[model samples]
Target: MSNNVLFDVPGPRARRTSRIASIVTSVVIVGGLFYLYLALEAPRVTANGTETPGMFDPTRWDVITDGRMWNAILVRGLLLGTLKMAAVAAVFALLIGVIFSFARTARSKWIRIPAAVLLDFFRGMPVLLLMLFILLIIGPGAYWAGVAGLAIYNGAVIGEALRSGIQSLPKGQRESGLAIGLTPVQTRLIVEFPQAFRQMLPIIIAQLVVLLKDTSLAYIIAYPELLNIGLRQLPTTYGNRYFFTFFFIVLIVYLTVNLLLSWVARIVARRTASGRKTRRTGPTAGKDEKVGVDTAAMNAVMPDSS
Candidate 1:
């Protein structure tokens, strides 16, 4: 007897059909993967005329055993190149997002309308095209071009998210702040904005993870980020036969970073929920003391009337 209005609860026969569908889907997926594995493992003729499955070849994967290879791919490419760019871009994006959010939410139509238009423009533009446009103006500095492009586009998206979070808040939040002698700007900055940011924090972090992955787009602009270094330079240095090995490593690193970010978001959401609960229950803690003091003060002021 669920009250959910979205759909009817499954009956016994429906449940059986759902379970059968699930099993069939799982088996099809497993079968497809196994077929893919066998296809990759099949023997093929190399450019040098030797027949072997590249996926199973030891020579292709031997580069992983080299310390220099790891140093080049992991240390230089991942840490210095990709992570550095992502860190700088993340900071800039956050700042721009806050500014854009405030502008978009401003009471003045002059500020809000233009801000909305600009945000829409950036949001609609492709990240790669933005990077290329920036590259043309910046001239020969792919890193800055990529950073600027990522910041601008993601800033607009984050701004919209924050705006949505702010709008979703009860109207009383704004009214209360204004009733307490705060100006509109003060009410937004000191009260509304912080709550909105906290409410939208998990979404913001998830957007940042998307930004991190988008750093790979810098490759098209000739920035020496992780993908360029691992997919291009490392393969050339280690021989093209090891290309898939480098690609596999890069794939794993991306997955690991994105997963860690998602985990952090979950932890933040949990903590935020717990903090709100604490605040909800906290006022009762000092209720008796407050009542006792009020009673004593009232008695003192009443004098001989008692």
Candidate 2:
């Protein structure tokens, strides 16, 4: 039996009951879907003289493969506009996050207090308000306002994540570095930060997920991001009828990007874990070199006797 950290595995009766429940749930879901299909179709299931299409109309689905439509919408709005903003915002956010996190953790209260206040204020504030504030400050129609808004807000969140990661490390780590004659700043930058970063990498990636999704808020300031593109195209190109099909494409793109990022995070986490394991095992490998050095010293000392 495999041991799970969270919960115990079900026994025979419990497993059987679970299986039965799942089967029942599946039947109910299928029945409900079939009922919905009938309901949607019944309205226009007839050869009514109306020109309007029904919910399950095959003609509506044809829009999914409209290459010309999707090409224009996706290329500019999704790839160029949305992705570009997310990339710029993410980079700036990560940089600001790291800088402020360092400041928040600094020995000096002057630096730490301001950093803390800044992080707390931005993090607690609504992203919409932040976007509006930046837009007002920088004037409207400027793309940088949107990017700056996202960066500042997400940066505060990311900084908190970093600060928590640093704080979660054992006190012994800091003490050990100090005992080795390193100053507090050096100890933090050298010994503590690297390990904390490794430990907090998953959290950092999760925060990036939030940041990516938050890019949609840029649309409030008329920034032509993914959601804004969808909004503009919805009324102009297809109207409200094809709304689902249009946004479905956007959903797929978001899912693809975030899934790719998650995959990268997993790969990095594995590499870091393996690296730590190798470091832990390195001393044993060095023992063999120590033996070779002792043998060479013994041979040199006994050379005259030979």
Candidate 3:
């Protein structure tokens, strides 16, 4: 026998609404971009002004195919430098996140207060301003400047994520571990920290995305990232190709990176879920199992031997 219930299946109202919203947003964005393109192209030049090779030359992408302005000066300086800076910043941010996470969870103020203030100070500053300030002191290399800015800002955000996730764990979880004779360090290492990390991972991924985008700001300090390449090319060749160039850069840097990271994250989530299910069902490896004899004893001892 089986027990079940039936109800009317809802029509695809929600799906239809989502489709409508997607269509409307796409229409608006494409229309607005087309309008902006026509508007910009209308009067970009000073009439008979000497076009830089790639600026407003209209020479059929001569600048892009050639890469003259960018290759002339800032090829590796910006393209490769931006990548290195972003990588360094991510490393520093992760390191600072872990350090600050421990600080927030540690037992004493000597750990938390100063760390909190430093974290707060970094997070409070605007990323652009931070980059500018660091660039002045570090003097225009995209590597250190972008890294210093991202480390301070992204690290602060990540630290907060870790701290909040740790705090969000049930208080009883920590106390129970301690009651079993685990020291604060041992309890956090064995139990609370793992749960906290799993919860905070999505947030950390989000911050990494932000940091990667912020790397675009490297051009402001004259570090010559992808945007810098576009900017340098625009003066002479594709001055009016602003929309296309900028959006191309966005698609390349932001969209591609986020999509790839999201895919990897999904895989990780599926693996984690499988591991958790396995742990829940499988008995502890070292536990003693009382099987056939134990079952027979219970049956034999039933009331009235029945």
Candidate 4:
């Protein structure tokens, strides 16, 4: 009685087999996790006859629970430092990205070629190396060095994202704009870029997550970002016995920020997709608007004029 034919419905035996396989996989995963916990939770004997704490040790976690230590240093200082640096970098990166993208798409070979080379060069360089180099060029503890490094590297990446988005647009778009007597520059600016940005919004935001995480690299330059602060506290707080615990805290912070960015990207993607669908299905939004033309002479010259 059913018309569905794309994929055959699984039989009872097949369902049972899948259930068994899933159960086995779950058991294996749980067993592996328990083994990992046992391994990392093992404590070491220190030189002073005291047992050095491992990841699961309660003493190592007191800093996170101590209200004064946690709120005053980690929350107020280091995290704010990280966010401030990332915010500055993100802003400049976006601006630079737009400029470089325009340059890459320019009419002149002189502009496009150099823009392409610069984009490729920065994109090819490791972000850490750039940060280190910039720090050396500037000075230790100069916050703007981290900002400049992140912006330049990520700006190039973002430029490529925008460029690819623009290039992915239908050729007919460019052709029709030209057919309408618009110059190439005018066509790209007025007709193509808006749609291209909508298409590339998700990718651009994902790049921003990378930029946020890369802010941790500021630690190497001795800027008081989250990771540096955590590492600095590691010696006194945990006596260097709980390296993994401190790192795990930093990892959680990075993960939470990136997760939030991804959530925002998803929301934006949904809205953009729905808007595109509406434009496709509904009346074309101003795209069909045309100036009125005079009809008096044509009507008079016509054989069947009203």
lDDT of each: 0.81, 0.73, 0.67, 0.75
Measured by lDDT, the strongest candidate is 1
Candidate 4 lDDT tens digits, 10-92: 88998899899999999999999999998878887879999876678787676577676555346754567788898999999
The true-versus-predicted C-alpha distance at residue 116 of model 3, in Å, is: 2.2
Residue pairs clashing, model 4? none
Backbone clash tally for model 1? 0
| Best model per TM-score | 1
Task: Determine which window of 10 residues in candidate 3 has minimal summed lDDT.
Answer: 297-306
Given candidate 1, what's the lDDT at residue 204? Answer: 79
Q: lDDT of candidate 3? A: 0.67
Residue pairs clashing in model 2 are none
For candidate 4, the TM-score is 0.80
What would the per-residue lDDT of candidate 2 be over residues 247-271, giving only the tens digit for each residue?
A: 7677888888878977887787677
lDDT of 3 by residue, 155-264 (tens): 87787777776776667778999999999898988888777777566557657767777888777877766666554645445555444544454456556666787677
Worst 10 residues of 2 by lDDT: 297-306
